[model samples]
Target: MRYFGGLVHAIGSFARDRSGNFAVLFGMVASVLALGVGFAVNVSQLYNAKSSLQGVVDAAVTSTARDLTTGVIKEADANKSVQAFLDANSRAGILSADQIVLDKLTVDRTANTVQADVHVDLGLYFPIFSVGDMKRVAASTTAVYSDKTIEVAMMLDVTGSMAANWWAKTDKIGDLRTAASGAVEDLLDNNLDPKNPRVRVAIVPYAEAVNTGGLASTVFVEARYGSNVPPPIDAPVSVSLTLAPDKCATERKDKDGYADYSPDGPNTPRLDNDGKTYLAKVNRDDHMKTCPKPELIPLTADKQKLLDTITDFRADGVTAGGIAAQWGYYMLSPSWRSAIADAALGAGPANFDKKKVAKVAILMTDGQFNTAFAGGRGAPRSQNAGQKSRSNAEGICSNMKRDGIEIFTIGFDLDDPSMTMTERDQAKSVLKNCSTADTSSLKHYYEAATGTELAAAFDEITENIEKLAIQR
Candidate 1:
């Protein structure tokens, strides 16, 4: 009986010895397996989410960059479109686009790029997993392909009043030259263009009267001595050779010695936005023959001619922007390429050639147009008519735009005019219709009350140009 009891006890002992050890081993194995499964689920979900949404970001960004500077679309509204695309398509692939959360989207105006940030919260199934959450952050590729040259035309105001401290602390003439040349250097120094043509610049200095170069000096000079056209006209100032006999004189002997050929003539001509006069019966299309050599002197060139030309600029005469605007139009007119084949500015025509180029003019002025020939070759003396001149100049600039020459007109430091407010307002009205550039690009037209503002304005414009140059 005793022997039988000992056998049973040994069997019980063996069973008890292994029970606790088996339980411990099973727990350890289960915990390890649980963690492995959890991490696998999290990693797999995150990887799938990133792969799917990365495509979404790329597509959205590429689409957004297309019309960045075209003005075809407004920015605020465009950004909303981008945001919606990213957010709506956030959840898209195996893990689901919804799983990938959109954080924010931004469109940079000056940089011309679209960027988006997002993250995915990976959900894994494992109750005993050590960490409950896993996340992955991602960013979209920056998309704005900038690789084009910037084109610039510096149109400066060289009026007589520019000699006066008309623009705040600075005089008009010096101020214009300083501002203009500075803007030029900014473009060249930064090398705005990443493409072959590079940023090309032209300096157009003008006043009440532009320097009329004779054909002997510049090809733009028309046959003067033989032709009936008199020397360039000057601004209308109160002089001894007046148009009216003065309210004080009634002798009516035509004492001023200037011919009165019916001052304003029969009708007011209707010049369209492109300087195309529907009423002038005379075709001014030949005006392209008037583009002067412009004394190349490129500031961007390694030589110093451009700097010399700018320094030599003198402020004289009244403000006659009409001639300035007209020539600006002609310089960019493709028709002139043939006319200037041998002229100093012959290359100008090619540079502005229509078939293979985009033409833009930047015209800056501080005064209104007050002198236009009406009664035929003399000062307008009857009643002091300034509105007509302003209107005509406005018409010419506007017409230039219609004619396909992109114009950027700057109204810089305009002072109170000698004429009524109506005349001043009439002149101000011209700038609104200036420029063939898209409304979006025209935002670059800057008004500087102070010199610092002028520099900043220039910087802003160049920055924008750099961004959009990709498509030049």
Candidate 2:
């Protein structure tokens, strides 16, 4: 009877003992913690799956949109393109490829948009105390494809400095030609269409002056004679006397009733205060000397002609970047559209419409603006100028930007061996200021130290242009 009583007492003590309470409490806490950890793991997996699916969907839609804009594929092939991209970038660990479902793939031709909706059934890493073992994740993306018309004016520097060697290359001019041709190909390759090409390129090879060539009479007020004797004021001169073999043109003076940086028409004659013609001054003895002989090619979709023009580039003359920049702007200006049409270069829209067209100017220079001329009709000549040209360039750049023309400036080996650091900095600063402001989506300035770097710069610009053309 005593032994039975002791066993009962021991059982009662054990049940009332506080020392074993910790183990029971820890067990309860651990169960909850394990469930929380399991839920977190599943949540993390879902998040990862969502991100991966979203990336794939975005890429697929973007690719489809680009292909559609380029006419590389039709609406029927958009689904195939999206599927192929998704298959190529399958996230098997986070979400099974087989479980991924493309719910919708749409191409709106009228809207020029591509949209995709995707869903994935992601298997949970830990499904303890969960409603289901798998979670559904979805992603949707839309991309707009534009078929806007693109006009590009490429202003290249063909000065005497281009004759120097470029990064072990035989000739810097040759490297420039190669890089420029490559950029043209990148932008215009497969761009031709029978109805209307999406892109047109114009080349303005400039040095001391821009060569208007056959378009001079159409665009300029009057052709200047090569001789020092100013032609009789208000008297008609023979076209032969006025025309020169090398079509180097001087910038019109501000006093000629033409705004300092405004585009001029034939009716607006750039004449002296006395209403006399201003002859194109030739500082050098050789008539064709120091001239970038390649005539400017206006906006044209003829790729072969562009390539041929690039191939035929010859480097000469001093650097007059301001004049070159002005001509670059003119190439894209709607005011000059009629001039271009009359010259048989190409046709432009009747008016400037930013919604339907994108105008871009790529101005490249290898040196500073060291040469400039002011005054005519036996007036005291102002020569070997500097600040005047730079200021003019800045004004022109500001005007072009104000008119909604995108300006891109490239400083190719702008550092002069003879210049001080301050001078070099000034030169670069001027060029940078002349370019359009750098933004998140667009880069307007580039500095290339070597030929390879120059090529890379051109390539980058071409890629940007292509993106702009497709996403307008």
Candidate 3:
């Protein structure tokens, strides 16, 4: 009886001891806490990886859509393009490129959508209830895109200053050719359709005046050689009476001088000079020859024609930005449709329909506008020339914006050391004021200081225009 009691008492004492229970309980709690912490870390990692993956997929699909719309890649290559982009950007978060899998890619031309689905198998730090050691995070993205018809007019400056190099260390004329030509090629690439064209570009190269080409005789009022014979009403006094060559036309004296009226509506005034104008005094070889060499190429899809025309552009005469602006407007204005038709150019300057078409203008200059026209002759050869020209350009810009024409302005090397601070500021300000206000990532104003930057500016503008065409 005593032995039995002693054995029972010892067992009871063992059960009552709290020291052993504490260890066991602590072991259980530590295991649970470690698992909870591990699971939380895995969840955070998974969330981050998923978010990163989603961003990559979104960018890939959007880029693919843009390329498809721009004809940079065909429908057949879209999947490949997206895959390449994904592969390149897969290492975004804690995820490696090797872990990402492109599960599906769909390019629906009928729907104008590019869709991509991707997944990443992320190794977990700890396995949780009802979950494996790895988590499969998936992401899907789609971009909708379509092309719209666009009309663009580029107003290029061929003023004498373009022949001189500024801070850019390269001749502006040479750079203009490269930049403008490249832009044309990019803009018209696979864009021209015989049945339904999507893009048309007009080149308005301006100096002292715009070369009207075949329309000059029809639009220009004849002025007999030698000046002082009743200069057109409001015409400035001539230092020399010189005549615009056969294909050149100056400002209009009629009610439509600053207006975007058709050439048929009002005849442009005559510019007659005979070595008595300020141009004659300047002593520059081409100063006496007032007309720019590059004629206005109306809205056309002929890329090669445009390339050739600008390639032959020569820097001469003074900056006549106001006249050039007016011509740029005419190139897109429906009112001047007949003039373009009469010139044997294919039908263009389509009637304004904001919903169906986008009209855009790009005006580029390297120096201040120092020339203007009254009647048919140059504006008074004084400081008023610069002010008048800038005012006229801005006025035309306002009118264009009101008419739904989007304007972009580029000031090339305006910070040239040769120009006064005031002059540079005025030139820059004119361009800034002329441009359509910036919106989103599209900047309507650009100041390119070098030839490379100049080319880039053109490329950027083309890209933005392309984006506008392909709205997402």
Candidate 4:
């Protein structure tokens, strides 16, 4: 009895003592500290997971929206497209694909938007306090998509140098054909609503001059200045003015050349053959002329016609980039719609409004712009063709850009060992200065060293165009 009572008394005393109070308080504080640390850790993990999920979802939504806009997939297939994209890229981030659960996908046709909501049950590494073992991390993204009309004028170079030598067992022109054809196909294929096409492409192949083809008589100012053919019935020929042939069109004399004036305003001047200005009408199919065999095809949604035209492209004459750029502008210029009425679509190039339509010009070249007409005199194959062509091209491009035309320029084989430093620089300068500056991933200027790079560049440009069409 005495021993048991003494033990009870000692236990009571120890329990009532305040000497161990500090240790007890320390244990409680330590537990709270551990819980706070765990909570912070879990919160950090969830934040990271949420951020990663949002990125992936944004990308998936944007891609799916593009697919919908391009008519690559229908409304019914949008969910699948988004899910597939999520699956492919989900693992690319911090979270695995399996962790992500696509909660819902909404395709609002009226709004032309694709919105995706996704969530992930992230297993907590440290479950502290009253919180559960897992937390839900969710993300939702919306991308606006629309089939805004797109008009692209591709200014391709068919200069003699493009066919000069073989690289990678194929000449530059051959490579150009392949690259250009592929780009056209990519742009026009599976065109949403063929009858009311969303995209139209125009090919403007040029060398020493742009072959006006059937429209030559309408747009070209024929030779006539007391030195040759008679002037137009309405307009009198200037006595001081030299004359040019009616085969191919060259740069205009004054500001009208750089300006995107209608054929009704001031007509384009004809190209002069060699040093001799045209005194009278010459054979339209004269092989001695600097005009390329391939004529400019205005904006059309017909994919086959475009492909055929590109396939038949032949390299000839010297580079006349300024004249070609001018024609490219004309193709997209709404004022010149009547001039190209027969060749282009019923609507022609859509009004130069970025909101209603996207007008893009793709200027490509393999060498320097060495050919130009001095007044009405032809200056073909000039070793020192000054900055005339480049300056004119830049001026025309500036006008196009001011009118909301997005320009993309490509320089193929500019790094060729055979080219002189001056030649390469001049060729690259015009292309560089012509392209529009872009804030996105796609650049407006591309330097393609080989055919493969050329194809890749075109592909990238096509992607840029598609993205450009999609807003928000």
Candidates arranged by lDDT, highest first:
3, 4, 2, 1
- List the candidate 2 regions with Cα displacement exceeding 4 Å: 1-45, 68-77, 106-113, 122-135, 143-145, 165-170, 190-195, 219-246, 253-260, 264-290, 349-351, 374-384, 419-426, 466-472
Model 1, position 203, has a per-residue lDDT of 62
- TM-score of every prediction relative to native: 0.53, 0.75, 0.70, 0.71
- Report the C-alpha lDDT of model 4 over 253-278, residue by residue, as the tens digit: 43212222222212333333333232
Off by over 4 Å in 1: 1-151, 164-169, 190-196, 212-303, 351-356, 374-385, 415-423, 436-444
lDDT score, candidate 2: 0.73
Cα RMSD to native, each candidate?
A: 14.8, 6.3, 8.9, 7.9
lDDT of 3: 0.76
lDDT, residue 338, model 3: 69
lDDT string, candidate 3, 1-472, tens digits:
9999999999889789869987899899999999889878987998899899999999999998877766566678888998899889978877786677889999876677988999998888777886888789999999976644689999999988899557546688999999999999988886635455678999999998788775553343334342222234344646224443456655543322322323222223333343221110111112224777788888998889999999998998898787788888888988677666876976758877765577899999999988765422343345376787787788778889988888989999898888999999999999999999998778889999988999999999988887666653
Best by TM-score: 2
- Return the TM-score for candidate 4, rounded to 2 decimals: 0.71
In model 3, the runs with Cα more than 4 Å from the true position are: 1-23, 41-45, 73-127, 131-136, 142-146, 164-170, 189-198, 214-218, 223-245, 253-289, 337-342, 350-356, 375-386, 415-425, 448-453, 467-472
Q: At residue 342, what lDDT does model 2 achieve?
A: 77
Model 4, C-alpha of 124: deviation from truth (Å): 10
Q: Per-residue lDDT for 1-472 in model 2, tens only?
A: 9999999999888778867876888899999999899988888888888888888888889988888776567678889999988888775446665666889998876777889999987767787664678777999999997666788899998887788565645577887998999988877875747457777889999887788875766423333343322343456656324434556665554543222476544334445556666532222212223656888888888888889988988888887777777778777877777766777777843245665677888988877776555422232334235655666677778888888787888888766575677667867887898888988987989999888989999998877776666554
Give the per-residue Cα lDDT of candidate 4 at 298: 80
